[model samples]
Target: MPPTRVGAMRRRGLFVSGAIQRMRHGPAPGRWILLIGVSLVLGVALRWCGLPAGFLLGPMIAAIALSVAGGAVAVPRVPFQLSQAVIGCLIARTITLPILTEIGAQWPVFLGGVFSVIAVSLIIGWLLTKWQVLPGPTAIWGVSPGAAVAMTLMSSAYGADARLVAFMQYTRVVIVASAASILAAVLAPSADGGGAGSWWPSSVAGRGGTLLVVAVGFVVARLLRTPAGPLLAAIVIAALAQDLLGLKLELPLPLLAVSFAFVGWGIGMRFTRSTLSHAVRALPAVIASILILVLVCGGIAVLLVVFAGVAPLTAYLATSPGGADTVAIIASSTHVDVAYIMAMQLARFFAVMLTGPFLARMLTRWSGYHAADRA
Candidate 1:
């Protein structure tokens, strides 16, 4: 062979050897770089397209694709925990004094709405479990109307399949967000055009305080070693500090993006070929259950309108089953009672967080009993 041909052949052999080595030893650091790059591109695209939780969803989808294709890469434990803590803080920051005051003024109405939505979700989850649509408490967690990311993280702690739960949760988020946006447009067409605020923190002290809170939460979670401990701890600490101490919690856009990417990658990289196949098969049942929950919540909204005398649009948005962030966006743009809507959303969120584990255990026991009876 000519010198040029020999060099080309040698280069090709080296490439093949490297490929084989990577397969045996798992992906290289370059795989991580590639994953991050792809995740960023997709995240930005999805966000531009107006998908709720697009950044997280984009990374998750990218990770799933890579994992299923055998390019599996795992997020580091520390980063994942910190990301969870950041997400917890994000949730806590939503609970402002205005939202709390709204809930306080009509505690009964808020209580009714919260429990009503929770009860409906439980019923739908139970039906899915009884029908054997998904395994164990996965269906229950999947159908829970809490914040999608929070539910997905907490579900893993309860021994449910996080991959499946993530799938179900995000699917519902997309549907609910889209439906809510459409309804808002139709019902309140005149009320549009609220722009997003700045993504950067206004003051260094606020950012530092928020980081300090996250650190404390990280330590507490490390000591507790509970499932999703970081997330739960951060939420409690940040919420109390914000609501009671009048401290401002600030999370810059870059910090949030990184944290969301970490979470998205962590969950996504865990998906195996079997898991992906299982999720595909379960999609129909999941969609049906989500729709049922949405419809039931709509009925609850009607009750709010008739009895509580909330505006029709506000009631609908407030009683939305999932996608609190998306609902907030719509509520902000529209001429709805934003405070009341957020209050109801936050109320349902806290209620789910408190009762989720108990409900999971109950569902597990009930599933076992039902299975035994059938056997």
Candidate 2:
């Protein structure tokens, strides 16, 4: 073509090549930094918009996107424990003498509801095993409707596949969390704009006392090796101090948001390609099982609302098939009775811990017996 046109094209090519080379050798930001920075920005934006569980959900979604895009990222266990401590302390603040009395008064309803949910879980577990949807012991442990960590830990002792148990448990957690956030939005859409934590406490005595309580809780939890030890210890200690010493402790909203982000990161970072593939393959069966559990729990909640005259929100939160700390966070966000919901979850947690192993072993025997009969 023309000489001037050819020179222009050559210059354009050189410019493009220079840009590519710079990109290859440039001081680009680390992938981890980009991932974290992006997640924080998106999460805070969502929180500002007043979405239900926005901080947690926003970070979780961002992390999931990065993980799927092959980003090398990880969340340490210490952050997970710290997140639990933040939530645990928040929940403990909601407990009171009146709420404790209410729980005692409603003991019959609470016990019946807990037992019914366990029975439903057991039946679902059997169906999954019977249909070969999941392995017998994994199904048994997975469908226990207890704390995921506790159930996963219990699975090994009962000869269940820990990996499968963990997979199922976390699946339920994700589903329940997503559903609860949607429900919270539908039920309570208003923003609550108070109670941010301060770096400096209002009083020196208050700061010292609260710090002492938290320190003791962590130390005690570590010694015990309890599942979710930090949370359990914090809740128990904070609750006792509130009742006995009339002490009140509060975490600033900013700190609480950070804890939520940490928790979301911990969960999302667990989603490797292999795990994601297996989850997709098993999605239909797992979704069906979890949906059935949710429906059954919802029916129980409705019954409590009608027969026991409990508040609808309280009933629903009480029977929610998520973790206790999760239930507390959702309940608090929705302005519900955190103590009552927590009480119900605590009851279920203890019951599962007590009966899960025995039941899993029994189910294993039943499965073997049935297989032998078929043979």
Candidate 3:
């Protein structure tokens, strides 16, 4: 109320404002502030709209808009890594002994389905090259039905257009994830079996045990040079501990939201007008290939339903063409048979990761195309 008090309050306010500006601007002020502020605001707004995976969608859209506008923005790796770990934890919690037993019993069916998916994906790739929609290697890598990021990273080495491949791969992820979520909402409203909770253990001993498992997982995944390292590690550790050791670990809702936001932002930030224009030009071919793959995989799902005796939703999930990470999230959110879907997705992922390079080379050579050496 007095002059001294008012002066002091003003000084304090200025100090706080300066600190915030420093944080928002980082080393470079104006653009970074805009990027962070817009992303945060949009992410929250999307979450408020009750959108499934709104946290991801909002930030992603914001990042894409900024990128297209030629704004300099990048989501650092730490947020993305934390997100991966959170998702890994969420996925690990879904695995259980009963699910493992069920999957083990149906190994024959899984084998058949995995083979079918690979065979069909290759066919789609061939079709793209035949139509001259893309180059041979790009077509192959673009339509590989593997994890988007992994496949994209491998694309250049295999003589594919890495930018084009990334565009195609991530676009399909967005489409498939959106469509699957919508379908689940409409057809299986009760599928979501999870809700918010803290993953921390109650006692110090429990906390130590949980951390130990996660740390071990992180180390193992890194050692193996796995893509999405922390996530894969977390999933492996969580699942083994839960199923074998009867341990329970979970990620809280807020943490899950933040992770989703980071992953979404990471994908969206890859876009620019040049890359997007290229993607649009190739959209017709890409969409056709994806459609064919989905339909063929749908047939595989039918077999899963009839022979494996799982629900139609579960069958469809097991055979979803891409987005293994997204599939796990959808499975958990919709409460579809998590174990079965994850098992099938994992089967396809490993198959593609282990054999994708060799197969790409073979197919290119067989088609009378030489694989390019960029390294």
Residues 1-375 of candidate 1: C-alpha lDDT, one tens digit per residue: 899999999999999778645653465586776688789898777566554455666787788777777778767999888977876776677667776676688889888988999988888887777777787778989988866767888887776778898878766775786687567656865321222223787988878889988999999999987656777788779989988887788877677778777877876776667666769888889888888889999999999999999899889988998655445545654566766786688678778888988987797677663434422
Model 2 TM-score, 2 decimals: 0.85
In order of appearance, the predictions have TM-scores of: 0.69, 0.85, 0.82
Candidate 2: Cα lDDT at 370: 43
Show the colliding residue pairs in model 3: 191-334, 191-335, 192-334
Model 1 residue runs over 4 Å out of place are: 1-28, 91-94, 129-142, 147-202, 243-246, 279-281, 302-375
Clash number by candidate, in order? 0, 2, 3
| TM-score-better candidate, 1 vs 3 | 3
The C-alpha stretches of model 3 lying farther than 4 A from their native spots are 1-51, 190-216, 371-375
lDDT string for model 2 (1-375, tens) is: 999999999999999767544533444345456556767787767657665666676677766766665663667777677677777777888889998998899889989989998999898887777677775567878877857888987787666667677777877776777787777767765365212356545666655666677677777888898887888888899889888888868576776777777777766665556656656666688889899998899899999999999888778878988777666666767767778888888889888988888887787677663434321
Q: What C-alpha lDDT do the candidate models reach, one value each?
A: 0.75, 0.75, 0.73
- TM for candidate 1 is 0.69
